[model samples]
Target: MPALPDPLPDPVAPVVPLGQDPGRAAADRLLGQELRRCREARGLTLRQVAPVIRGSVSKISRLERGESPPRPRDVRALAAFYEVDAQQMRVIERLLEHAQDAEWYEQFSDVTPGFLKRLIQLEGDAEEICVYENLVVPGILQTRAYARHMVRAVMPSAEPEEVDRVVELRAERQLRLMDGPLPRVVALLEESILHRRCGDAQVMHEQLKHLLHAGDTDKVSIRILKMSREWGVTPPYPITHLKFSNGEQSELAYVEHINGANYVTKPRALDDYRNALSNLRNAAASKDESIDLILKAQHRFGDRTAS
Candidate 1:
């Protein structure tokens, strides 16, 4: 039970690079979460952990929230204090390295909101993504026209250039669904969203066709909640759940609004979202039925275009 050096030895080079990468920042966040979990489990407060790293309480808090990248030395000191085994220490070091690397999304910083930047970081690492949409199509599944129209509709004052960048950002996110082990995606859409017109008839028609195509993917599941089926409830607004790969199997819930967004980490709140999603799934039309609905909507839009 000896104390490690307050400040671990500094490296010859800078700990953080010149560029900012949310993906790398996300790694730092994961490291911080693990550190915080360890400290709390050992019944240690931030004040006590601070001295071990020769830092302040706020630093400990920030590290835990993954607000900033952690120093390798500080991570090691924390592992020692937490009695983390040697095997996990290596993983922490690797995460620190990855935190310094640049991510593709960094290029879109101009148009990306702060909350969305963090969400993107989380999404990149998530193994499963569950989304519920009532207002519009989820960005991950949106076609280019659909995304552009939705973006412009929501932010009419946004410059055309900015609108284009936001559309590009959405397209960039879709790449994750294509790459690596495709994260299992379960999306529940309100039946009305299919009928809501974003752009012209042609745009809605293309979007619906795209939805059908996306649903065909083995990893993607799309279901629609019909208006006729009374669930005795108004389903909650858009909810996104991200499940990460870590020893603890952590999950984060994201709820977005016009003013801002909320990132929920509390177990109870997450459980509530999970249960609500379950109910919505239960009330939704079967996958085949949902596809049928999508096709019908597509044909309806096609007729509008023809007329």
Candidate 2:
């Protein structure tokens, strides 16, 4: 029988290198995904990769799932073991460099659930984000007062401090809409959602005003689905579609449920959500019409306060 190729010498976890600054959670995730693909492609399992990387199976699993960052030397060792060429080697190195940075949201780790952490990671790197809101305004476009009302309403039993923390976290996320290279946001809001009394009539009015201002920006497009329209089926879930521009340029659909969230990656499922979003866009009011509707709703809310 022909001799089998020898595996590369066992590796030690290299001194983890750091990036320019924090906020590399997204990069770490992308790198982990690439590592998993390489491992699976070469018919290797977590158990097999652990020894080579000088880690346990769980550690390898975490690295593969982007649950943890990977060391540069560990990445190099895996590349060599997989017989990756010079070009691929460089790619791995690039990913390792990206994976080294800390996440900005790490401070909220105590309050943030793992599922939400994953969502935030994806949100950080998304080039475009599409959100469908059935009840309230999408969090990314919400004003502080509106978001605070939402937090209080949803978690009525939560401590005041916790609610405040949640509101603060939401505010931080909203900054993404303008702070840096903005993610183009396409938000579909049900018409009745504007009328749903959150904090008070004044609160709703102020929120609508905020929405109007946000919609005016070139990066945001808000559309309202009228109540009278014969919309087919109500969306079974709130959908968030994230589109990325760099690396593999992956597209993901985040479906939120009562307890947790589901990430849709299968092509067919993704297509379904994509098509639904397209249909919703067509059925909703145009940009100008949406702005007009929002203005009308704001006036109505203001009227309630006057009376």
TM-score of candidate 2 against the unseen true structure: 0.67
The sequence of per-residue lDDT tens digits that candidate 1 reaches over residues 1-307 is 1221112122121112224554566777887877877788899999988999899999889989988667778888889889977777777766665564345677998888767776776676678899999888999999999999988888999999999999998987887564555478899999999999989988899899889988998888999999898656644578888887763547867777766677766666667777777787888899999999999989888765443
Model 1 spans with C-alpha error above 4 angstroms:
1-102, 303-307
The CA root-mean-square deviation of candidate 1, after full C-alpha superposition on the true structure, stands at: 15.3
With a 3 Å backbone cut-off (N, CA, C), the pairs that clash in candidate 1 are: 29-66
Mind sharing the TM-score for model 1?
Answer: 0.67
lDDT of 1 at 61: 92
Every model's TM-score: 0.67, 0.67
Error of 2 at 37 (Å): 33
Task: Report the lDDT tens digits of candidate 2 across residue range 1-307.
Answer: 1221112212221112222323466667778888887888899988888899788999988887778767788878888888877887777776775465236566777667766767776776678999988888888888889988888887889898888888888887777445555568899999998888888887888899889988898888999999888958657556888888865437877776666667666666677777878788889999988998899989988765443
| lDDT of each candidate versus the true structure | 0.77, 0.76
Off by over 4 Å in 2: 1-102, 303-307
